[model samples]
Structures are given as C-alpha cells and as structure tokens.
Target: MPIHNADIAAIFEEIADLLEIQDANPFRVRAYRNAARTIGEYGREVAGLLANGEKLPKLPGIGADLAAKIEEIATTGRCRFLEQLRSQLPPTITQLLHIPGLGPKRVKMLYDSLQVQTLDQLARAAQAGRIRELPGFGEKTERAILEAIRAHASQERRYSIALATQYAEALIAHLRRAPGVKQAVVAGSYRRAKETVGDLDILVTARQGRPVMEHLMTYDEIADVLSHGDTRSSVVLRSGIQVDVRVLPPESYGAALHYFTGSKPHNIAIRKLGQERGLKINEYGVFRGDERIAGETEESVFAAVGLPWIPPELREDRGEIEAARAGRLPKLVELKDLRGDLHVHSKASDGRHGLRELAEEARRRGFQYLAITDHSPRLAVTHGLDAKRLSRQMDEIDRLNEELEDIRLLKGIEVDILEDGSLDLPDDVLGRLDLVVAAVHSHFNLPREQQTTRILRAMDHPHFTLLAHPSGREIGGRPPMDVDMERIIRHARERGCYLELNAQPERLDLTDLYCQMAKAEGVLVAIDSDAHTLLDFDHLRFGIGQARRGWLTAKDVLNTRTINTLLPLLKRTM
Candidate 1:
C-alpha cells in the first residue's frame, strides 16, 4: 500500500494520543502532534519525495526524528513507535478521543477509575449513572459524553477539504501521467469545494491502450481494492477515503463529469430540463432520440439545456439554474479578488512570526494591507496581549509602516466578548485601534437568547468593526454556538459592523448559508485568515471556496476594497 501524508499523519496523531495517555514527556507528545499537523497540511505527498530521492522539506515542527518516522511510515505503511505505544496501552482507548469533550487526560481517568475502554462501555457507564461518580466527571460531563457517543455513532465520516485535496491532487497527477490518458478531472463535492467530502469521483478519458483501471490499481496508496474492471474501479485509500474512477469516451467526458459532479437535486433538476426539451441526459451524453447532440464540454452540456455554464460551487439547486437561464449567474468571488486580510495575528499574541515578517509575507502575496488583530488578554491560554502589550505592538506596527514600502499594517485586536456581553479591553484601549474584531472566546454553551444578546451587545461597542467567526464552530469537532444568527446579522447591519468568514480549515464560520444571509441583508462580509502563523495565510483559499458557494461577489466582501476605501467603510462602523 502507498502511504499517503494523511496516513502518516494519522499514525503520528495516534502515537501522540497514546503517549499523552501514558503520561510521556510533554515536549515529546507535542512534537508528534505538531508533526502530524504539519504533514497533514503540507501540499505535497512525502512518499513522492522519497521515491524521487529528494530530501524532504523541513516542515514546521518536524525535526530529524519525526522526519525519519515519516519516511519509515511512507516506506513500510506502519509506524513502529505507534505500534510500541499501542502495546503499552489498550489500542481501543484511543478511539475514545473521537468523542467531543474527552481529552487524553479524561480518557486516562476513565480507564484508571472506571475501566471505560470503549465507546460502548463509556456509554453504558454514563447511562447507568456511574460516570458522574468519577473525579471531574459531573452529571453535565456524563450527559455530554452520552450525547457525543450518540452523535459519533450516527455520523458518517467526512474528510476535511484540505486532506481531501491532498489525496485528490496526488491521484489526479498520477492518472494524468498514465500513457494515452487524454484528460482527468476530480468531480463531485471535491470539485464543488465542499467543506467536507464523503468520497472522490474521478472522471477520465483515455485511449484503448491506456488501461487507466489497471493504472489505478497500481497506485501506492491503495489500501484495499474493492473492485477493478476495464472501465470502472473502486478503492479505499489508506486514509479511509474511497475513490471511484470511471473511464469514458472523450465524446461523453463532459456529460459524465456533469452527471457525477452533481448535488443529486441539481442533477435531477437538470435532467428534468432535458426531459422538457425532448432530450435525454446521462453519463453517456445528451441525446435527442439516440442522436448525440452535445457532450464534448461542460459548456456544451449546459448550452444543450438552454442555460449558461453554472459554476460548480453554485450547483446546489439554489436558484443557480434559474439564474443561469436568465443570464444572471453571479461572477463569484475569486481568491485574486481579495485586496487584503482583515484578521491576522503575530508573535505579539500567540502567533509564530513578528510584525516585519508578517508584513513582508503579505506584501509578497500582493496584498495591499494586512490587519494585525492579535488576541486580547481575555484569552490567557494564547498569552493574549493586555493594553500595555497591545500599545507597544501598535507602536511597532507604526514604525514598520514607515520602514515598509508596499504593505500597510493596520493596528487591531481580536478582543474577547466576555460572558456579560462586554468587550475585553476598556473603551480607551479599543478606541485607539484601526479595527476591533470581537469574538467569543469562552462560554460556548450559553442559551441561544443569551448568546445572541451577548454578541449583539458587543457589536454595539463604538469601536467594534467586525464579528470574528460569527458562529463559533469547529467543523466536525464542535457545533456552532446556540445563537440567533439572523438577529446577529440584522444587528450587524444596523450597527454598521461587518461579520467574518474565518478561513481556517477547522473554523469556516459564517457558513455558506450565513454568507448568503449577510449578503441578502446588504451587510459586507470579510473573508479573513484569522491566521496564527504565516502558513495560515494560505487558508484564504478555503474561505474563498465557502464564499463562492454562498454566491458572494467581489462587491459583497469587505476586504476586496483598497485600503483607502476599506478604511472609510470600517470607520462607518466606528
């Protein structure tokens, strides 16, 4: 089997979890966890580098030891360190970590105190009211564990877009290199840029001698070949994502891509249109009484149905077809349309780079401006800055502005919205910044009314410029806070404040639906990186994906404007 970066990363993550449960050195555990993160986010496959006899790039947090382990796992499809850790602990205990609110410490506590080794055992203990008797596991904790177990049991596994892209791109590259292969493209939700993908559908066109199916089976990453044939094949990658590849004639490639890249309802609706036009559409091609009409390209397929080619991101049966028919399809926001990032962090508050490095990187990326919204003191875990530290950082930013030539660094703070709906820093401190991004750092479990009111109150602050991660969600890990988002969006419009579409893969907050809601209300949304490190700036692409799906255009985004225009709009909030 070919070891994917995700596969190696998963092993390292498991090793870290087991080591933490065994009470290993904190630095040792951190090293493994950080290596996993670095490898998981890395753009290229580590195995490919090793295959070409190239030295692995020195990834962040990966030292010699971790790099050696990555090579070993890539070559052998197993991590001896993880295996050794499993020997010292119950391998099943690692599964407990999947339950929300259960960390390694709590898992260890459950194992030592109650012998809860599996989800079933933990669920039974919680139901029997035994978990509450354990130290730190109160009734609320026990109840939460039960709920998490239920949710986990019922949820289908989905891969994050970043991870999915790693696999999809590697596979596409491999297939394109196959002899006689004319074209290959990843379809389905991966092409649609969905936040999470259930699987990948690859459509390809090849000559008679190409044997794409055979080539797929030869891939190094195939963990299990479920089936293989002359024209179709299915396999599960080591990282647990299923891939299905279909070979089609060049004539039908476009129709096949359209058929498979569907949002089910969208495809059904399109087929209905075909029926109304006295045409039949399928993976084969668009036919009028067995006479192939159009299928050579996606545009031809759409044109056959009297509609313009809709962007895949908007093909969610969300009025896209109607818009296409009426020639009103939006020119969706693209990554290049962004003029700057409004929420960025530096070493002043838990970020990895300094002000100069951040500014240089932003300038290198062609951004006209970058906001240094370091965390406020309320988030102590991140060593968030107080007024004194923030003031000093502001002074440094001003000095850098004078030194730097191309990029302007705006002074800002990601101020915490306290439980009582108050801003973390005093008004005097907040008033001095170019922008104030209010966020809820704690108390995620507040009642919907309380959460909504708390956020509204914070937005009412005269200095408040934007709401960061308007919905406090962490994708699969944590659900969005119980807040009335409609009310929040309305209040933001009335207050002249903006909302954020945080680009971090884990927190694509202000979801696609909410982005449309904000747009509908005539409220500008800022697609921000909320970056803690330099590499995080690259995550803006994911935010752009979300915005495009929400039907956002350049005009609907706040950061698309130049600094001069953006400053005036931000001042309107003040």
Candidate 2:
C-alpha cells in the first residue's frame, strides 16, 4: 500500500495520544503532534519524496528521530514505535480521546479508576454516577462526556476540506497517469470546495482500450473495493473516505461532471428548466426529443437552459440560478485577489517562525504585507505576549519592515476576548498596532445569550479591529460555541469593525452561511490564514473557498485592498 502524508500523520497522532495517556514526557508528546501537523499540511506526498531519494525537509519540532519515524511510516505504512505503544494499551483507549471533553489525562484517570477503555464503558460509568465520583471528573464533565459520545455515535463522518484535498488530489494524480486517460477530475462537494466533504466523486474520460476500473482498484490506499464495473467503481480508502469513479466518453464529459458535481436540488432545478423547454436532461446529455442539444461542456449545459456558467462554488441552489438568469452573479473572490494576510504569528508567541523568516516567505508568495498577530498573555500555554512583549515585538516589526523590500509586517495581536468581553491587552497597547485580531480562546460553553453578549462587548472596545475565527469551531473535533452570530455580525457592521474568515483547516470559522450573512449586512470580511507557521500561509486558499461559497466578491474582502485602503479601515475601528 502507498502511504499518503495523511496516513503518516495519523500514525503520528495516534502515537502522540497513546504517549500522552501513558504520562510520557510533555515535550516528547508535543514533538509527535507537531510532526504530524507538518506532514499533514505538507503539499507533497512523503512517499513520493522518499521514492525520489530526496531528504525530507527539516520541519519545526521534527528532530532527526521523528523524521526517521515519518520515513518509516511513509515507506512501510506502519510505525514500530506506535505499534509498541499500542501493544501496551487497549486499542479502544485512543477512541476515548475523540470524545470532545475527554483529554488524555481524563482518559487515564478513568481507566485507572474504573477500567474504562471504550465509549460504551465510559457511558456506563457516567450513567452509574461513578464518573462524577472520580477526582477530576465531576457531574458537568460526566454529562459532557455522555453528550459527546452520543453526538459522535449519531453524526456521519466528514473530512475537513484540507485533509480531503490531500486524498483527492493524490488520487487524481494517480488516475491521470493511467494509460489512455484523457481527463480526470474530482467532482461533487470536493469540486465545490465545501468546508467538509462526505465523499469523493471522480469523473474520468478515457479511450476505448483504457482500463480505468482496473487502475482505480490497484490504488495502494484502497482499503476495500465496494463495487467494480467496466465504466464505474466504488472503493473505500484506508482513511475511511469512500470514493466513486466513473469513466465517460469525451462527448458526455461535461454532463457527467455536472451530474456528479450536483447539489441535488440545483440539478433538479436545471432539469426542470429543460423539461419546460420540451427537452430531456440527464447525466449523458441534454436532448430535445432524442436529438442531443448540449453535453460537451458545462457552459453548453447551462446555455441550453438560457443561463450563464455558474461557478461551482455557487451551485448550492441558493439564489445562484436566479442570479445566473438575471446576469447578476457575483465575481467571486479568488486566491489571487488577496494582497496580504492579516492574521499571522511569529516566534514572539506560539508561532514557529521568526519575524524576518515569515516576512521573506510571505514576500516569496507575492504578498505585499503580513500581520503578526501573536496571542495575548491570557493564553499562557502558548507563551502569549504581555503588553511589554507586544510593544517590543511592534518595534521589531517596524525594524523588519524597513529592512525588507517587498513585504511589510503589520503589528497586531490575537488578543483573548475575556469572559466579560474585555480585550486581553489594554487599549493603550492595542491602539499602537496596525490591527487587533480579537478571539475567544476559553469559555466555549457559555449560554447563547452570554456568549453573544461577551463577543459584542469585546467588539465595543475602542481598539478592537477584527474578530478572529468568530465561531470558535474545530471542525470534526469540537462543535461551534452557542452564540448569536447574526447579532455579532450586526454589531460589527455598526461599530465599523470587521470579521475574519480564518483559513486554518480545522477552524474555517465564520462558515459559508455566516459569510453570506456578513455580506448581506454590509460588513467586509478579512479572509486571513491565522498562520502560526510559514506553511500555514497556504491555508488562505481554503479561506478563499469559504468566501466564494458565501458569494463574496473582491469588494467584500478587506485584505484584497491595498495597504493604504486597509489602514484607513483599521483606523476607523480604532
């Protein structure tokens, strides 16, 4: 089996979890976690690198030993250290870590006290009222664990866009290399750039002699082949994501893409339009009484219905068809439209890179500016900066800006929004920066009313410039906090403040709906990376996807403006 970067990352994460449960050294545990992150986010496949006899690039927190482990997993599809750790622990123990409120320590305590090794065991303990009797696991924590386990059992598995991309892009490349292949593309929600994808729909066009099904079945990552046919096949990857591949003739390529890329409602609406015109539309082509009218391309398919080509991101049947009919579809924001990133960090806080290195990397990516928004002091786990440290970092940013040529560093902070809604740093400190990116790092369980009020109060601060990751969601791991997002957006509009569409894979906060809501409210969003490492800057593309899905245009994005225009907007909040 060909081990993907994600596969290796998963092994490392499992190792980290097991080690943490064993009460291993904290630094050692952190190293494995960090290595997993770097490998998962890396653009290239580790196996490909190894195959080409290239040395893995030195990543932060990845020492020589951890690098060796990565190579082992990449080449052998297994890690010896992880296997050893698993031998010492129950296999189901790691699953406990997936429960939202259960950390390694809590799992360890439960196991020691009640011999809990699985969700079932934990649930029984909680129901028996034994969990609350444990030292750290009180009634509240016990109830939360039960709720998380229930939610986990009920929810369908969904992969984050970033992780799914790693799998989909790799498979697409693999298919393109097959003999007689003409075109290969991933359709469905993956093509639409959804924040989470349920599965992959792959469409391919090939010559008559091609062996597409054979090639797909041979993919190294295939965990099981669900079904196989000459023109269509379905398989499950080792990562648990199901993939369906279909082979079509060149003539029906566009129609097949449209059918597979559908939000079912959107396709139904288009088919109804065809029906009105006395035409039949299906995956193969659009026809008028058995005479094919359009099928070669998506544009033709749309034109057959007297509509323009709707961007795939806007194909949610959410007024997109109407807009297409009226010729008023938005020119959605693209990755290239961004001029800078407003939510970046450096080693001054929890970030991996130094100021100069981050600036050079941003400049290398053609960005004109990058903001260093390190965490404020309340987040002591990250060594977040105090006022004195923030002031010093501001001076450092000014000096670096003068020394650099193309990229300018903006002084900023990802200041914690206190429980009562006050800014982490004082106004005097916040006012000196180019922008202040405020975020709520704690108290995620506050009641909806209290959470909404907390954020609104934070926005009222004189120096508040932007709200970062406004929803505080962690994708599959944690749910969004209970808060009134509409109220928050309205407050932002009134106070001249901005909201952020944080691009980090796990926290693509301010979801597509919220993005649309902000757009409707006349509020501009900063599609920021919230980067903690140099590689994190690449996350902006994910943010752009979320923005496009929300029907955002360049004018609706804040950082799409030049530094001069952005500066005045920031000043207004100050």
Candidate 3:
C-alpha cells in the first residue's frame, strides 16, 4: 500500500523537526525532512484519498508508523502522533521547526528548563543568558541562534524561480567543468521550477575514485564538506546551503538522473507503473530480467511504461501519469512569448538605479518599455513621493522619453491600498500617473474573507491598474495569507485588472495556476521582476518560466508592448 501522501509527509516533517531539536541523528532528521518535501511535491490531497482503502507508504518515506498517520489524516483530517508529541508544549513552539539551526532537541531543552515556547519568549531567554546555560549549548551556539533568528526575519524566504535558476546555473557551470565530470544537471524543486527553493541539488556523471574525490575537494563555495565517498560528495556552502552530488557511469546517467530528480511520489508512481508492466527502474536503467531496456532521459523512462513526457515541474505523481496516458497534458507558457514587467521601483523611491539607467537595462533585455513605478507617499520608509515629488518624477520621465532612443519609461506609481479598501492617493492624485499598482502593505492577519474583500474593493476602484504579489507570501517561512486566489483572479478579470507575476525571487505570487486561470478568464498577466537592485533585474528569466508555465504569450504581458502601445493600456486603467 502506498503511504497516503498527507499522513506520511506530516509525520516525516514533524519527526525531522523534533529530532533536530532533540539533537538526535542529523542524517535521520534530514532524511525525514527531505522525504516529506519529496512527497509533498506530489500535487494531490493525499490524506483524503488514503481513507478510501488505499495502500499507504507506496510513496517514498512511508515507513510503517508514518504511513499509519497518513491513514489517520485521511480518515480523520489530523494526525494523532503529531498532536500527542506537541500536547505538553505551547503551540507556538512549533514555529521553531522552521528556524534553521534550533532543531527539536534545543527546543525541548528550552521548553523543559525555561518553560518558553514562543520565539519572543526564547529571545528573551537568550538575552538573559538562559540559552548558554543549557548543557552542550555554548556562547557560540547561542549567538548563532540569535543571528539565525534575525536573518530568518529579514531574508526573503520565497525566491522567484528566476533567482533560484540563476544560482543553479552559476553552481552547475562550475560542477560540470570539474575534472572527470561527464554530465551534470540540476534536479529537485528548482528543476520543477517551483516558486521557492531551499537549496539546489545537482547530479553528475563521473569516473569513480580520486578523480571524483579530488574534484569534490576543489569546490569553491563549499564552506564545509560533509561527505567524500568514491562517487558521491556532500557539502555545505557558505550560504548555509547543503549541496549533494553523486557520480555514476555514463551508461547509468539517464536512469540515475531520473531516480534522483524525484518528487518521491512521482518516482514511486513511475516505479509502480514499471512493476505493473513487468519491468523495473532504479539508479540503474529500466530492465526486464537481466536485459536493460531504457532510461538515458526522462522521456525514455516514461515511454517505457507507455506514458508521455511530463514537464519536470509537473512530475508530481499527481495524476500526471494518467493525464499523460490520456494525452491531456496542459499547454504551458514559454519565456519567448512574454512581453513586459508591470511592477518595478527606481531612484524615485528605494530603488538604486535612476530612470535612464533602468530604461537602458530594460532595452538590453530586449524589453519594449519600463514602468517607472516609484513608491507612493504612504510608504514613508521608502521616501515615497508626495504629489509635488510625484510631479517632478513624472516630468523627468517625460524628458527621458524625448532623449532616450530604445526603451521608454511609462509613468507609474506603486500605491498602497490602505486598510479601508481605498488606495492611498485620492483620484486626482492617481489620475496624474500613467499607471497605478495597488498593493497591500501592513496588515497580514486580516480574516480570509476581509482580506479578499479589501483587495477586491481596491480593485473595484477605477484608478487601480494592477495588483502586485497578491498573496504576500515570503517563501518557506511565511505562509501566504488565506485569500481565495481563485476569487481574486476571477474578480480581477471581470474588473479589467491585471494580476502581476512579480518577478522578484521572494514573491512569485501569482502562481502558474493563478496565471493560467486568469488567462483563461481574459485577465491580462504582467510578468514583472519587481527588481530593486541591479543584480535582481536579471531574475526575469525565472519569471519568464512562470509566465510560460501559466501559458502566457507576448500578448499577455504589457512589457512586450512598445511604449506607444503600453501607454494607451495604462490610460484605459483610469
């Protein structure tokens, strides 16, 4: 029986966090954590289906007890084991599960000795010297925790797929060129083009022994090397990143890559399909008896089981196999078809580059135009513009238009949508800007209904042009506000509002599904990188993937339009 998705995953995640806090086996914790992620990538309501007499743990990581909890979740919508484990502790302690270094052991010790659970309480304890007092926890460890907490607060958790892609490309380039390297490629969530990536994993083909071992020792960014086996290497980068690379023979490259590029559930389904067909698959190629048959590429692996090619991102074993067999794969969007970015900041606010410099950058990227959307006056922290300030910036853009040759700057403002569901500026103020990007700033804890109503009401405001990072999700740590994304997309379409594909790595907010639905419903998609710094600008490639995944075409993006064309569309927003 396949371990039902939710049960096995929940147990694994909790167990990993608990074990980490317990200071137990680091590898065991990592194994469970990785397994949970691999299983969760399968896009289905797993626990629910398992209740209907399904095999549990057929998915990877479904050891007996973990599999049983999946059955529990499927049957009852909750896991008893997780509930029991946390029963004596304050619920807020669970949040520590997310903070990088303080695993289950540290958490338990803090709870037992200090009777503290929430981060606020723990911070106070650390300041008071309670953290250092714990046996085995030194001043250095305590300082590290405090630093991680602060970093955890400021670091963008959700990166745009584009940013992750850049890092992957940078890292892979080096790994591929290492001595004895044959073939190397990125696998895992990055390969699937997920909105956020915790780390990047690359697999390689190489000769065994000293060639691979020596090359492992030469990795530039490895802050700490963890393993150096004959054909496998694991290292932690200076950025707190753990990268695992394995080497295999050229003949096994295809099968090994397939096995390693797992949304574990997807791989399990593929394995099961092979079994049903009297074949087998592993790090070795697909085989029937002693005869090797296929698997040098994912396409061949799938073909062997009578399935069509599935996009790496969609290989979640989420009925993808059945869909492919039925010849019903959804058409995904591509970068070439996307046209422009709707949200951006410049020197008019907190952005580093000035108008001309920014415009030229856009031109280099082959963009037709850029929207000089400085921060609105409400965000004083950003040196946002008042009406007088706004007028001056608009004038500069007007002058730049006459002088600049290639790209044009569209007058725009990233206005704050106040809590009252009204935009920060009055209609008269908004009327002056060529385009308005209405966004929510402060309140993230509003009820789901109220949050939806607030954004919807703002969209109804005639001056609103686009919505940026609609859900306000930051990535791994912050969960997206519980808005009805489907509703937002539908309403935006009917109201003639454009939903932005914020190209910023931290907020690929309008996900592929939302963009797809919007396109279907006649809503325009604006794939903007929302670049703040110069380095951030190149991240548009990942945003292009999101647009492609959402089925966006050049016609869907506003940046694809020449300045002459984009102006009228902004005018229509008013």
Candidate 4:
C-alpha cells in the first residue's frame, strides 16, 4: 500500500502519544509531535519523494532519528519502534486518548488509578463512582468523561478536508490513469469544501464503466470493496474513508455532478424550482415530458431552471437559490485575490523558518506583503517574544526589509487575550507594530456570556487589529468555544477591528455562518494563512474556500487589498 503523508503523520503521532504515556523525555515527545505536524502539513507526499530516490527535506524539528523512521515506514509500511512502544502499554489505552479532555497524562493517570484501559472499562469505573475518587478527577470530571465517552462512540468518523483531499486527489489521479476513464472528479461535500467530509462521491465520465470500476477496485489503498457494478462501485480506503464512484455518460455528467455534490436541502430546492418550471431534474438530466432539455453542463442545468450556475460552495440552500434567481449571488473571493497574509509566524516563535526564507517564499507566491505575527509572551511553550525580544525581532524585520525587494514584511504579534480581557503586551509595545492579532489561548470552557464579554473587551484595545482563529477551535479535536459569534462580529464592526478566517486546516475558525454574519455586519474578514512553515502559505486556498462558502467577496476580505490600500486599513484599526 502507498503510504501517504497522513499515514506517516499518524504513525508519528501515535508514537508521541505512547511515549508521553510512558513518561518519556518531554523534548523527545514534543519533537515527535512537531515532526508529525510538519509531515502532515507538507505540500508533497514524503513517500513519493522517497520512492523517487530523493532525500527528505530538512523538515523543522525532524532530526536524523525521526527521518530514518519516516523512511522505514515509507518503505516497509510499518515502524518497528512504534510497535515496540505499543507493546509496553495496554493495547487499547491509546483509544482512551481519543476521548476529549483525556490527554496522554490523564489516560496514564486513569490507567494507574482505576486500571481503565478502554472506553468500556472507563465507563464502568465512572458509573461505579470509582473515577471520582481519583486524585484530580472529581464528580464533575467523572460525569464529563462518561458523557464524552458516549459522544465519542456515537460520532461517525469524519476526515478533515485537507486529509480527505490528499486521499481523494490521489484516488482520482489513479482512476484517470486507466485507459477508459475520460474524467474523474470528487463531488459531494469535498467539492463543497466542507471543513470535514463524511465520505466522497466520485463521478467519472468513462468510455467503459466496467473498466473504470475495475481500476477503482484495484486501487492499492482500498481495504474493501463494498459493492461493484457496471456503473457504480463503493469501497472503503484503508484510512476509513468511504468512497462511491459513479460512471455516467458524458451528456449526464453535469446533472449527476449537481445531484451528488449536494447539501440535500439545496438539491431539494433546485428540484422544486425545476418542477415549477414544468421540468424534472435529477442525476440523469433535466427532462420536459421525456425529452432531455439540459444536462451537458452545470450552466445548462441552471439555465434550464432560469438561474445562473451556482458555485458549489454557495449551494447550501442558505438563500443561494434565491440569490441566483435575483442575480445577486456574490462574486465570491478567490485564492488569487489575496495580496498578502496577515498572520504568519517564523523561527522567533514556534514557526520553523527564518524571516528571509519566509519572505522569499511569499514573494515567490506573488504576495506583496506578509505579516510576521509570532506569539506573545503569554504563550511560553512557543518561546513567545517579550517586549525586549520583540524589539530585537522588529529591528531585524526592518533591516531585512531594506535588503529585500518585491515583498514587504510587516511587523506584528499574535498577542494573547488574558482572562480579564487585557492584551498580553502593553500598549506601547503593541503600538509599535503594524498590527496586533489577538487570540484566546487558554480558558476555552468559559460560559457564553463571559467568553463573549472577554473577546469584546480585548477588541477594545487601542492597537488590537485582528482576531486570529476567533472561535478557538481545533476542527475534530475541540469544539468551538461557546460564545456569541454574532456579538463578536458586531463588536468588530463597532471597534473597527477585523476578523480572521485562519487558513490552518485544523483551525479554519469563523464557521461559514459566522463569516456570513461578519459580511452582513459590515466587518471585513481577513482570509489569513496563519502560516508557520513555508508550505503553510499554500493553506490560503482552504481559507479562500471557507470564505466562498460564507459568501465573502474580494471586497469583504481585508488582505485582498494591495499593501498601499491595506496599510491604511490596518492603520485605522491600530
């Protein structure tokens, strides 16, 4: 089986978890976790690099030992060291780590105290009132753990869009290589750019359906073929992602694409529109009394119903159908419209690269400006900068700007928002920077009103410019902080600050609905790449997708403006 970057990352992550549980060296554990992140976020497949006889690039935090492990896994499809670590721990203890609020340390504590190595074991202990008797876990914590266990069991597995894209694109490429396949593209929520995709709907226009279906079944990554037929096949990939491939005639391609790439509500609304127009629309095509009227293209399908073609991101029945009918659908933001990134990090903080390398990469990407917003001192784990250190970094940024051409590096800090709503850095230091990107780094479980008030107060800071990853979410790992997003958006409007659509795959904060709220409230949202490595600049596309899904236009995005235009805007916030 071909090992993907995600696979390599997963192995490294598992190793880190087991090592942590064993109370291994903290630095060693951190190195593995960081290496896993670098591998997972890398733009290219490490396995492909190895297969092509290339050396692994000097990845941040990845030393010789980790590199060797990556190559071993790539070649042999297993890591013996990880297997060794697994042998020392309860085999199922790692599954406990999947439960929210249960980090490796807590899992270790639970195992030591209650001998609970599985969810069933943990649940039984919790029910027996045994867990509450433990040192740190009280009655409330016990109840929360029990509820989390239940939630974890009932939840259907979903892959982050970034990881799903890796698998789906690889599979699509594999199918397209087959002789009879004319076109193969993934539809459904994947096409819609949903944050997490439950499964993939792949549509292919092929000369022979059987040949394409046969090719799909032969894919090296497939663990099981659920069903197979002339026109359709379903298979489960080793990653646990389910994919259904449908082979359709060329003429029905557009209609089928529309049908499957659905938010069911949107599809139903579109069908209702077709019905009212004396036409029937479905996966086959649009028909008027058994005669095919339109289906060859998405534009044709929409035109048949007296509407323009809707972007997949906007087809969520969130007034998109009405917007199309009125010709008021947004000219959604595109990746190319961005002139800069507002939130990026470098070696001075937890980020991997130096200023010069990051600047060169930004210029290579045609960005006119890139802001370096490393963490504030409050985030000690990131080795965040203090006032003195920030001054030195700002001085370096100034000196580098003089030597650099084409791209300008803006000085900034991702200052933490304290619990009492004060900015982590004092006003004098914050005022010297180009922008201040405030974020909530701790206290995620505050009540809705307290959280809302805290953020609103933080935005009131004189130099506060942008809110990075506003909701403090980690996609699959953590739920969005409970707060009134509407009030936050309105407060940004009131304070003249901006919001961020953080492009990091795991922190695509400001949910789509919240983005729309910001749009409606006249607050400009900066679609920022919150990039840590040079590869991270590529994440802006994911942010752009999220912006489009939120109905954001280039005008609604802060970074869409040129530096000359953007500086004035940033200045106003400061």
Top candidate (lDDT): 4
TM-score order of candidates, best first? 4, 2, 1, 3
lDDT: worst 10-residue window of model 1: 206-215
Cα lDDT of model 3 by residue, 1-574, tens digit:
2333434555667766656665767756765665565454444446435556556435543466556655566566566656765674555777766665565777788888888788777778778878998988889888877876777778654444543554456568777767878778988777777776667677887766457667667765567988878777778765455678777777777787778777899999999999999999998799999998987776788899998878776776656678788997766556654455667788678676688778887777776777777888887767788878888888888998999886677788898988879987778878877789988886876899999999999999988999988888766655577788888988987887788888765577778788768877888878787866444556676777676656566776666666677778777878
Write the residue-wise lDDT of candidate 1 on 1-574 in tens digits.
5667888888988898899888888778877776776687676778878988998887655778898999899888888878887787889998898888888899999999889899999999999999999888899999999989998999999989978888888899999887679999999998898999999999989755337887777788788988888888889987789999988889998899999999899999999999999999999899999799999888889999999899999989999999988888889999999999999988776676788889998999999999999999888867799999999988988988999998999999999999999999988998889999999989998999999999999988889999999889898887899999999999988888899999988888889999999999999999999876677788999999999999999999999999999999988887
lDDT by residue (tens digit), candidate 2, 1-574:
7788888888888998999999999878877787888888887888989889998998876788988998888888878888789889887899998898888898899988899999899889988989999997788988988888898999888999999998888899889887789999999998898989999999999865248888887788898999888888889998999999998888898888898899899999999999999988899998999899899799899999999999999888999999999999999999999999999888787788899999999889888888899999998878899999999999988887888997889998999999999988888898899889999999998999999999999999999999999989898887899999999999999999999999998998889999999999999999999887788888999999999999999999999998888888989998
User: Candidate 2 regions off by >4 Å?
Assistant: 138-141
Model 4, TM vs. native: 0.98
lDDT (Cα, 0-100) at 35 in candidate 1: 76
lDDT, model 1, position 304 = 93
Candidate lDDT values, in order: 0.89, 0.90, 0.73, 0.92
| Cα lDDT, model 4, residue 570 | 95
The total of clashing pairs for model 3 equals 33
Alpha-carbon deviation at 6 in model 3, angstroms = 35
The per-prediction tally of clashing pairs is: 1, 0, 33, 0
**Every model's TM-score:** 0.94, 0.97, 0.69, 0.98
Model 1 misplaced stretches (Cα beyond 4 Å): 19-32, 50-81, 138-140
